[model samples]
Target: MKALLLAGGLGTRLRPLTENLPKPMALVGNKPWLEHLIVHLKQQGIGDFVLAVKHYADVIKKRLGDGSSLGVRIEYAIEEDLLGTAGAIKNAEDLLSDRFLVVNSDIIHEISIIPLLEFHRNHNGLVTIGLTEVEDPSQYGVVELDMSGRILRFVEKPNKHEAPSRFINAGIYVMEKEALQWIPKHKEVSIERETFPLLIEKNIGVYGKTINGYWMDMGTKNRYRQLHWDLLDGKFTLPLKEKEQGKGIWLGRNTEIGPGVLLVPPVLIGDEVHIGERSVIGPYAVIGDHCELGRHVRCSETIMWDKCKVHDSTQLNNCIFGYGLEVGSRHILHEAVMNRAVGVIQG
Candidate 1:
């Protein structure tokens, strides 16, 4: 099956980081967030993919070429203009000839797509949408479904006092080619705002498939940080194993560490990480590739990406340091996020 990935949105909510990256390219752990999505989709027997891109489209294409490495064939539909989700799919109308899956690129989750596909085939619906229960439906496009899983209504973000259900759209869907007929070409259109409501009004075959797994929208800095913590805590099922709790720490290949260092559990030091003597590392720190930690440094619940240097006596707590950052001697970073491209130092 072919899948349509909407990767064009400018990640305005995730500022600093998004200042240099599209949402899909944001790093979750050691790799781009989209890498997890691509790998997950490949494992589910969906080999052919089409990406609808606009903002920084070239960068995304350059990073993941042809999907050959991931064992999938990738084609791109670049939008010179900003098109809404439904409109972007309509733009790639020719590529989708049969039943297909569509997903927003910003979503991070276990990506267990087989059950949704099975649900689609079983019901033979024109469209089967993934829904997750949320605490507040007022902030989301809510879905009201019948006992048979048929969608009874698609409500826009309703006021808290008037919401019909707590199940919100998960931004993933299995759609048939027939649904494409409802989308207009080259116009701003949202699946939630325009298409789904019209489909329900016309009694089209719309169903909801509830997913039971880890799902998160990493669209903010806080959520981004939380995602790494969750992964380190084994919130998802993947090949990458979290280092055992209370195991002190596990440094990746070729790492160098000095004597008299105090290492803590739940810490991951990526390949070639350098640590100086007497440094105190965290129970929740993630040090990426080629990082250097100078003597007497203390870090806890922190994330330092590639090539970052934390000098002597510096302290970092609940902080995220972007790639290629150089911390001065005795500098303290706490609850701050630095963008790699911005070059702004945070204290």
Candidate 2:
């Protein structure tokens, strides 16, 4: 079945990281964010994909380019203007199959689609929303269901005391083409706010299937950092075979380590990285491709993107670095996230 990936959302909460980058293009582990999501979905037998993109659409197009590199067939539904959730689906109407799957842009999960498909097929509901339990129901629209699994009502970010159930929208949905009737044309429509509620009010069948798996939404800076930490701690597994190179370190090709360098476990040094002598890296440091570090540099719990250079005696902890940044000698930073180039620094 065809899966529609919502890759166009403007990541307002994840600033700097998403300043020049699309939310879907944010780096997760060593691969592009969307790449990681697609690889996992592809492994679960998703045949084809439709990326509905608006913001930074070209960047996504340039990187994914027909999905051939990822071994899946991909088509783009480029929106000229901002189309909200249901509108995005409406814009891609021609590309969608009779039965399709819709996943939110921020969602990343390991949940299997087989059971959800089976549940959708067996039930009489025209729409099936995959539901997952979350500790904070206040952050997401809560799904309430009848005993038969038919959805009764949806509460939009209800208070914890007033919440009927802890199960919230996992942002994965199974829908029939007929459901498109509720979504009007040439307008900004939210699937969560508009379509599903109308379906329930019309006595149309809308069901919820409780799914279990590792799931997280990268919506903010804190969550993004937590995602990396979780991955490093083995809470979730990356799809690539090269993820676990040796002793919890994921090393890229042609990486050079200077003598007396200490690499702790759970470190990822990308391709062509050069480190000077006596530098201590990791126990959760993620150095992207072509990064250079001078002698006596200490970095732990840090993630630096490609081409970043750390000068001699610099120290970093809990920092996130963007592309092509250069730091002068003897600088120390903690809990910082950046995207622009760095200038001179002193102790």
Measured by lDDT, the strongest candidate is: 2
Score residue 264 of candidate 1 by CA lDDT: 81
| lDDT on C-alpha atoms for all candidate structures | 0.84, 0.86
For residue 217, give model 1's deviation from the true position in Å: 0.6
| Candidate 2 minimal-lDDT segment of 10 residues | 338-347
Candidate 2 clashes between residue pairs 3 or more apart in a chain or in different chains: none
Candidate 1, position 326, lDDT:
84
Candidate 2 TM-score versus the reference = 0.95
TM-scores of the models, in the given order?
A: 0.93, 0.95
**Once model 2 is optimally superposed onto the true structure by TM-score, how far is the C-alpha of residue 143 displaced, in angstroms?**
1.2
Report clashes for each candidate as comma-separated counts. Answer: 0, 0
